[model samples]
Target chain A: MTFFYISAAVALISSVLAISRSNAVHALLYAIVSLLSVALIFFMLGAPFAAALEVVIYAGAIMVLFVFVIMMISSGPGSTQQERRWMNFRLWIGPSVLSAVLIIELFAVISPPREPMSAKPVIESKQVGIALMGPYMLGVELSSLLLTAGLVGAYHLGKRKDDAAQTEDVTIHD
Target chain B: MTSVPAEYGLILAALLFAIGLAGVLARRNIIFILLSIEIMLNAAGLAFISAGSKWGQADGQVMFIFILVMAAAEVSVGLAIVLQLFHRIRTVNSDEANTMRG
Candidate 1:
């Protein structure tokens, strides 16, 4: 119970910090921490498989993609001072107050007495696989199709018309 | 198992959702807005998982798997658009991209 609370609190705090950071890379780092802790929360909640997927997919793969884009788009190392100047301490106040209201609301929600459920059967990966393959097969296939389409679209959109010219220019400069 | 209540999970999910909302409403960066949307989607998934746990069903996890895939697709498309927008206007700030304005 304490561990669950700790993980949830950590997830909330890091997520707040993640969104508030002026530097995109710094925000991504904190977002990774937030996702990792959310995975821990999932594990504690009895969905170990989901937790693992959360860590592997959300924290690992997706965040890596975000970092790659951040690196590609950043103008280089010369903007550190400018980024530092933009990181205002006062920017924390809005998120802090909103999160505090949420924490208060959480306490209110949890305080209400309700009928406790009978213990739930642990959901393992095998069961998830069966469920996915059985009733949700169509969704699974569609999601794969969506991913493929997204990949092609992203590739096409991200390709620069001047890519060859830019490379040649760089080589000449070198 | 420590036998945590489903309501606790719901409360946590709500908190997360609210935080994500705050981020989306407050941040001007397109990437941050997208990240905030991801957080909101995760919150919804958490709520589904919590409800599934409460009812002792696998449907919630199944739904979450779909949500995960959708989020991945959304991010790829969104970032691609972001990249193109940056190439065009040389900025990722959402407010600066007003070419579509009437």
Candidate 2:
């Protein structure tokens, strides 16, 4: 429980920091920390597989992708200065108040007393694998299709016009 | 061993989601907007995991995996679009991309 609270706090704080940073790289670093701490919370909640995926996919792969893009874009000091200028206190106030109202409503809705239940056994990755391959197989297949489409779309969108023209000669049959 | 109350986990998720919302609303940069959206997606995943844990079921984790898959696809395509947008405008500012408004 202690670990859960600690990590939860860490996640929240880092997430806040991640969003508020002027530098994109700095924000990505904080977001990684926030993700890692969320993984810890998942482990504490007895979803070990989810925790592992959170760390590996969320923190490692996804964040590395963001970092690579940031590096590729090479947003310089001028961009950071622009970000700082854009992130003025007046811009923050309205959203912060709105979110605060949202949080209050959420808390009110979920804070009602409920029956306490006994703790369940940990869910192993093996069961998750079986579940995925069994009942959720269709979802898995669909997601794969979605991923493939995303890959193709990203390739098309990111391709340079000249590069596409150059490759057109190679795809003359198509 | 004692487990944290399910409500606490849920509250944490709510807080994170709200923070992400604020970021999305407040930030003008397209990259930050995407990052904020990631945070919001993550908060939803956390809520699912917490609810699944409460019920002692594997379904929550399954949903999380699906969410993960979607987020991956979204990020890849989103970043690609961002890259193309940057190439065109040379600016990451969302406000400057007003050419599509009219």
**Which one wins on lDDT?**
2
lDDT of each: 0.77, 0.81
lDDT of each residue in B1-102, candidate 1, tens digit only: 256688988998898889889999999999999888888888888888888788777888888888888888889888989987777667899998775524
State candidate 2's TM-score: 0.80
Off by over 4 Å in 1: A77-119, A163-174
Q: Candidate 1 has what TM-score?
A: 0.79
In candidate 2, stretches whose alpha carbon ends up further than 4 angstroms from where it belongs are A75-118, A163-174
The two-chain DockQ for each candidate, comma-separated, is 0.36, 0.40
DockQ score, prediction 2:
0.40
Alpha carbon lDDT at A58, candidate 2: 93
Candidate 2, A32-126: lDDT as tens digits: 77887787778767788998899899988888879778767866768777657656776455335434443443344236672222255678898
